[model samples]
Target chain A: MNYPSKLIEQAVLEISKLPGIGKKTALRLALHLLKQNEQTVEGLTGALSRLKKETRYCERCHNLSDGPLCTVCASPSRQENVICVVAEVPDLIAIENTGQYRGTYHVLGGILSPMHGIGPEELQVASLLERVKSAGEEMEIIFALPSTMDGDTTSFYLMKLLKPFGVNISTVARGIPIGGELEYTDEVTLGRSILARVKYDFGG
Target chain B: MNYPSKLIEQAVLEISKLPGIGKKTALRLALHLLKQNEQTVEGLTGALSRLKKETRYCERCHNLSDGPLCTVCASPSRQENVICVVAEVPDLIAIENTGQYRGTYHVLGGILSPMHGIGPEELQVASLLERVKSAGEEMEIIFALPSTMDGDTTSFYLMKLLKPFGVNISTVARGIPIGGELEYTDEVTLGRSILARVKYDFGG
Candidate 1:
């Protein structure tokens, strides 16, 4: 598209670099920004700049943090004895939102995707191993990764590495989601559900 | 979504305020920015701030411009006597990209929409009328707007106001799009095509 100004073109170019945004969508966004008040634009830019400049990685869990450790890792109430492993900070947030898990988390940054040149070396695999081996107390490592091939591969690789440590390794359950219709459920999930069906028990 | 950090939450809130973007998409975009280098984020923010803070509108036609007059309006090669009126700058860009018209453009900024509380005063309608009335040369005004109700209403309103002036008035043609299949075309478009069919000449 022939943008009217260099500034608009530059802004559109930068915005379109985002994951799902395209040039047209970027142009729309830029035009919308142009229509907004100067303070709104300043606030947006300030927030983005602060987010990029002030953000840090948790030393222990590798989650996004404003300091050396993330909130979960810094919290005394969180259990370090059982660490739930996730692929990214958003996954950690998702698990935290469930409010059922009391354990600490280990963020792998991303799963192993060989096609994308993302392997164990590129991830936090070695650091995770070091954490597990050096811990004084027994820690149960739970793989909270997705059920995708990459997630399974990463979990298996970690499990193989941790076999000698004698620590309990587990994974989150895979089945049809609650309130999901049986007819609408995918075949893989349906098959897994049947294989891992729970025994029916009536209430007391 | 329950964001872990106040910075992330604020950034998400600001980003989500853009048209068509929602909280989840905003979170994804914010996290993507968090993972980028500081320079990339700075470039985006700088471009946005410059676009919002330094951008100006053309005094003659209300088009987005860096100076008092827009590039088209200031260009000597552009015909000032024939003006193509559009709802926004993007429409002007679209027409320019077509490479079919060499006339100047008058951007209305937006079409009339009473439902959204937009009226003639909210647009550049008065300025457009002043330009038409005070022009040193006779002019032909071509209305290039969407076929929406608001676009039609705004065009008709301007037409009625310009009736006293002997200046020629016209509208961009509307019918089936080029290379479009008749079978798959919508009913309104098909009916309009039949009503507005152009005269066909077999040979010159």
Candidate 2:
């Protein structure tokens, strides 16, 4: 049968664009919206509008921020001398949810994947280095980057570049099943990995 | 610890307000936005913005529309002499999907749920009666409303009101489970219900 009004079709088309939502499911969602109270539907629509108008990124850590610096960067009690490097912001949140780590974070934007055309330039690696250098020679860096090969490569590269400052460089313990996504792993295992961290050697 | 930023917190809060989304899920969604490229994140944000700007209610059917009349109302070939009365837009879509019925529809908005303070006034029942009266004596109305108590109440009310105009009043077959949702039952069952519909008795 022919589709409903163009507006309904448009709603279905747009919803289908969401992750894992197909045409059938999209139509179902669109119709569900029709059944909801006008106020509830309007609320959802309003939220979507505000998402663009209200949100921005933290310039310093690349975490979502409403201001120039992220909240973590503005905080006084967190270890300013210790920065934990991570592959992405989700990884940072996973660590934060455990309520264990008190250090600040550096979101790399992504892992170094030459195959995907992702390089150091694509990541926030340069900003991280700049932040570390400015934080001082006494600062120790922790490469809490993911356990993937690309993550290892990124960690190794950062370690070598920072060796001139004679700062401490350590990577999280590796028995984490290489290529495993850190966000899905349990906190106990992740904490154990952090405690069993190993030192990285650079020829500098 | 202090939050990452007010913008991030607000975004998370707004996300948490969505159906089935909690604080932790909101955090995950917010972090996902941070890790994504600006273009990808903006795409989702852009879609959200368009959700409200482009949709409105069709005055004729009270269905969500981008214009004054909804898609079903705008169609030319649909039968005007017959109207299938349903409780919601999703029910309308389910019937439409079967490709069996060719009549136009009137969305009742909801069933008559007195327990929830939802009555005929809250629903589009008045509109259904008005449409029936306006459509004139030649029209036939098949009550495709659900089998729940509220459905029965709504159907009885509509039958009596529409009967005065000499228009035919019919209802969909009723083996539907008591208090069952119209959205989940299979197409075959729904169509069977329509075929087995019996005449309503007005307290003989």
Candidate 3:
């Protein structure tokens, strides 16, 4: 489509480069921005630039942070001996939203996908091993990664690496989620759910 | 959801203020940007800020422009005697996409909508009238506004105002769109199509 102005065309092109945004949607968004107050546009651009320029990853856990340590890693109340390993910041956020885990997290950045040239070195695997080895007391490493092949590969690799260190290694349970219907569930998940069923305690 | 950093939170909040974007989509977009090269992010932010800061409206047509005149208004090939009146820049763009019109355009900024406290004075109605009055030769004014009640109201008011000027006025024809199924067409449009049917030229 012919744009009315070069500025508009450039802005739309830049915006459309984002994932899931098309040229039409980008044009719509640019027009929406043009219609808004000048201060709002300035604020949006300012925030975006600041985010890209200043944000850093936590030195300890590799999670996104404003400083060297993320809020989770810096908090003294969080259990230092327990670490929940996640793939990315969004995954960490998802687990944090549950409000159930008091333990800190170690973001691996991504799983070990050999097909994509993403190996253990591409992630924070070395830092995780270092953290587990240097600990004076017992450390529980919880694998909260996805149930995909890459996730399993990473988990198995970590298990072998930490075996000599005598650290307790565990993984998140995979089963039929609460409120899930059996009929709608996939065959593999349903079969695994049945095989991994826990004992029901009637008398408390 | 709990954001990993203040910068991410601010960026997501700013992005979500755009039309059709929600908090979840904003978060996803922010993360995508974070993973991109720093230069790409800088380019996007720079383009957006420049668009908001330097874009202008054409002095003659009120369409978006980099200078005093938009590209359409600046072109010498366009017919100066004919003017297609539209509500905004998007309408002009839609008409331009047809590649049929050779006439200039006059953007009214927006149609009169009393419900939204928009009046003739709030739009470019006076400027449009001034342009029509200043024309030395005979001119044709085409109404390409929407078919809604507000559009009709504006058209009727313009018709009354232009009666003394004695200029030829027309509107776009209403009919079933090309490739549209007759059965799925609305009754009002079908009736108008029947009433406004043109003669069939078999020899041509």
- Tens digits of per-residue lDDT, candidate 2, A114-175, equal 98999889989889878877875487788888766888788888888888877887766555
| TM-score, prediction 2 | 0.73
> Which rank order by TM-score, best down to worst?
3, 1, 2
List clashing residue pairs in candidate 3: none
Residue B156 alpha-carbon offset, candidate 3, angstroms: 2.2
Off by over 4 Å in 3: A176-183, B183-204
Worst 10 residues of 3 chain B by lDDT: B157-166
**Candidate order, DockQ descending:** 3, 1, 2
The CA lDDT of each predicted structure is 0.90, 0.73, 0.92
The candidate maximizing TM-score is 3
Tens digit of per-residue lDDT, candidate 1, span B9-59? 889999999999999899999999988988999999999999998888889
Off by over 4 Å in 1: A113-121, A134-136, A179-204, B114-117, B179-188, B202-204
Cα deviation of B97 in candidate 2 (Å)?
2.6
lDDT of 3 by residue, B136-177 (tens): 989899999999999999888888887788899999988999
| Candidate 1: tens digits of C-alpha lDDT, residues A112-204 | 999999988888888888899899999899999988998899999899999899999999999999999999999999999999999889979
What lDDT tens digits, residue by residue, belong to model 2 across residues B6-48?
6566667766665555787666665555545665555554454
lDDT of 3 by residue, A56-104 (tens): 9999999999899999999999998899998888889998999999998
lDDT of 1 at A168: 95
